[model samples]
Target: MLAKGKDATAKVLIVDDEPAFRLLAERFLQQQGYQVVSTASVEEAQQQLGQFDADLILLDLALPPHFDPQHTLNLVPQLASRPVIILTGHAERDLALKAISQGAWDFIAKPIDPDLLAVVVKRAVTKHQLEKELLQLRQATPVSSPLPSLAGHSAHMESIHTLVQRIAPTEVRVLVTGPSGTGKEVISKALHQLSNRADKAFVSVHCGAIPAELLESELFGYVKGAFTGADKDRQGLLKLADGGTLFLDEIGEMPLPMQVKLLRVLQEGSYYPVGGREMQHIDIRLVSATNANLPDLVRQGKFREDLYYRIKGVTMETVALDQRREDIPLLIRFFLEQLKEQQGQAFALETGAMQWFLQKQWPGNVRELKNTLESVAAIAQQGVIRLSDIQLLHLDSQGGGADTEVVDSALLGGLDEQVKALEIRLIQQALQQHGGNKSQAARTLGISRQGLLKKLERYGLSHSSADD
Candidate 1:
């Protein structure tokens, strides 16, 4: 039997045709604290599913008008997200095995014992709830891949692998610095896998993604009645990471106030819940990653220097993909192998496509390259990926400019004409304001110096500005 008051919200659907069994099951489940819904036929089960979100279903193998097993088994796909336990007789063991193949959770022989029914329903509901929670957790902290691996042979990667091997077993905090989408999280997962605490939970929190006002409660959790919707006690990521590793991605984006609280927790190894009077103690290995410059943020007083030093016991820097161009082919091959393993179909790149991939400057680094290949693989004809397949997915035009409008009453023309006039006026003003220095003018106009020069040449104003 399940612990009392734990499954008060879990619902179960009964699809048995027999009225006696349905009532017995429903009453037993309701007494067990689960919301129960009953249906007399597969047809009715489908209708009930539309209105009721069940965590588990008690599915009967045969129905009236058509005592066929396949007829009832057809409902399995409709309840794909829920667990369906098969109801069968002692003589129908073979049919129950068939039901298992049709995706039934397990079989309970009829006439059903109340004790057995209670046990099976409770177990299925508990398992389903746990699975749902894990799914929600994964959605909350979206990772690059379900199974993160550092797959590359670049010199930078080699150094990273060596350093990870040396420090992963220790309790020292690690700070991974790199541009966005360079697989910093993968390195963090690798560290956890290599550590002595590998068997424990590996929790990750994206500091930049969460709102500043809510970050404290999110990390520290809260007790029941702590806030508007705090219905029950919840474990925060720090509490969940006890005896394991906690990865904080985009740590530089964390607010100063949250940083102070986090620093205190690190120093004292204990923290209070958002509304609780008592402090909770925890033990965890910390790993932080960010693309932002911590030193610069500290200099500007945006980040706390003490917190920065506390987090960065050792630093590992990942270079941009362009700096390690040789790893492009290796990464491509690794990604292709993963696709083949996952889809059970081989995918090959055409020579021209391979050459095209090798030549492009991937500003988004490994992530962009992997995504491009995945997209190409999806559209490739006959499992052969071509250059055109990839090219068709990307826009040909590379327009650079913000949607922000310049609020100047002096500019007057059609939309395009007005935009062009505004651009010219802004360029001229910026140039004049900066003493005709093109670089300084470009900075003022929020365009790259090269982009500014291209615009000047296109507008026939190349000679209007003097060089720095």
Candidate 2:
């Protein structure tokens, strides 16, 4: 089984009897830069398979007369390493169950949204690539060594390191809680590395990002023929981390049904995959992290009480960058050194820029800091990083009111209007600074594409005209 990564390009084979459907899928995937090959029948697909390699196989269940179950089953074993995703229209419970039992990566029901189909294809590619990379890594090295440690020496981090040392040796499930961009995942990795099962897989799952329907199979694995479109078997994250750690990031966002299933696994050390009969047992450690308060979730009955208890064997909170203001210089220096080494550019941070960085309230924390430094480093023409460059980087000034109040109060009518005016000013400043790329603008704002779109809508700024 593979662990997910950010950069995994998939080679997909679309096996659909409908020529129109195949063409549509091929066009969509091609637009996304994926290598897509399509065929109208299983025989044609098999011929292509013999000549070419595919990371993922998209198999449509109802493939006319000759391509029956026996014929398809014969081809499945041949794809020992590659994953096959089933495309189907069946909604009946029995048919879905049977499909899962037959060995499908996943089944997508008919009337698929093009955007969703593209996302599924991309996910399949990523999962297959992760599995391949992990298998190779396992074969290349001894499985008993620990994962790499996080490099940091600040007092706040030292406290976290100390907590990890105390918590990692046991089989207890740990809850590493912190705000987004505060290195919660890094802390989870540290706990895994320090643990006894460090040699085994340290599987990390981003619970909130994955769609609810697919989350169960992605975590627990699914049997072939379990659903209408399942053409091949898949091993879940729990099985992949059988003897190591399973880090569930954004645990707060996991749906209620999954929380129940997860709790059962924690209690019994066993779980049934999406379409499996027997309970699969695995000895593993759980390290869950989230920015949301699980306690509050428990109060609201959004999260399970038992699951919270199971995962909270040890709880450690990561301090946000703003709270640990003294560490700003250390972090800035570290990022600067990293930039200098990576870019091979001799650069010095201007005194004014360094002062501005220290005074600014970084709501996005460490991640925001690193990104700001990176942007400045990329744009700096001279050997020196200027205060002007720092100003151009739109650090979220919503929380910078302490220092800005005097100047802001002088220029503003009311709080809401003043903030909106400031936001507009900052957006303008960022646009001028970067010569305008919406994606870059979004990054500088520490917001998403959708969020930026809404902001642009609010300001009556046409997104197309943002560059100008």
Candidate 3:
């Protein structure tokens, strides 16, 4: 029998002429927690399937007057996406091979071993679920509202991804440069993930968001009474990130005095905390990012040229969404899947709406694209999504928010299945949102780090394949 925790809702269809055999198979599958349906022949099976959803089919070849596997093979095309496992006592080995060539998922020789049947059924059900996920990703959503994507077939993006794979293993300072929302932070997390230090801390600090007066203390800790507010000792980001990675975002905006201190840490592998007498030493990988042009900053005397060179051991750039237009549809699908968790249904863009999305300049880049998807999913119809649902020309007039109705809530799946699907998708999106930073993803999901790890395993979602 399949392991426990498998979806009890998985439906299996058993087609065999003998009533006793059919009864035995039905009882066996039910014991394994599958919803079972039985039919006596191909004709009855087809009729039953028209009103039932079956994840797997167990079809016996010698049914009724027909005793050929070819008859069952003929129904493969009409069965479409479902998996059909052939049950046969036929003597010809070549016939089994032919059955597989004709699209049978697998062949089980009769008198069927119940354990073997359970194993095949488990795998077939998993395959079907994965297929639905892939299919859901391809469908388009409403005008003005849309969808997720690490999706780009463009050579430029492909080259960037390739570079990430190659550069991730080396110990070097990496500078991620790109426009805001172009995924600079995403690449930073990828670098940390791909590197040998993947299991260690990936501490990130936003340089531009912090006040220069406090930025120094933020990076290099201060001892007790180091400052007016320093009632006790506090470790800086650098100390916290020992033996791991320190990500400095908006590096261009780092204060000159603080830049000198950072450069000292890079050169000496040690640092003096603010007003601290002790020089702490540690091993670390430094990754910095910026949307501003460092060369321009250096030329304008706002940034140190020496520090810029030290930080950019290697440079990578994430292009704007419009720069990789081929990825739009894929991103749309990804976003729709993410939206499904909260909205109870995923929406697709109509032809006119999708064309509009494909043509947009996307100044805000991937972030903007995702926000637009959320906006649209809020107002989309439950049935086939169309242009009018989002009120494309007048988006502001439309209530594209959580107030949106769930038109086809029941169409998605059973409540337990839906919850599991949502949990899986939410995990994926959260991982993407944090660039595979599990700690950050856990924080975003309001769960403990270990709890998130268990869930990731349960869903077969891996940190290594987060980008994929």
Tens digits of per-residue lDDT, candidate 3, 371-406, equal 876777666655334434444435423333222211
Candidate number that wins on lDDT, 1 or 2: 1
Among these predictions, the greatest TM-score belongs to: 1
Clashes of 3: 13
RMSD of each: 28.0, 25.1, 21.7
Cα lDDT of model 2 overall? Answer: 0.68
Between the candidate structures 2 and 3, which one is better when assessed by TM-score? 3
Q: Which segments of candidate 1 are over 4 A away from where they belong? A: 1-148, 395-468
**Candidate 1 TM-score versus the reference:** 0.54
Cα lDDT tens digits, model 2, 1-468, are 111223335678888888788877877777777777888777778788876678888877667667464455444424424556667664432342234323344455676656656665666677667756754543354212123233345677667767778877878778888888887887888787788888899999999999999999999999999888888988898999999999999999999999999988988989998889978999988889999999999999999988888888888888788777766655666666677778787766643345456666688898987888788777765667754454345432435564322111111111345656898887777666777776567557543333355456657976664442
* TM-score, model 3 to reference: 0.52
Clashing pairs in 1: none
Lowest lDDT sum, 10 consecutive residues, model 2, at 405-414
lDDT of 1 by residue, 301-335 (tens): 99999999999999999989989887776677778
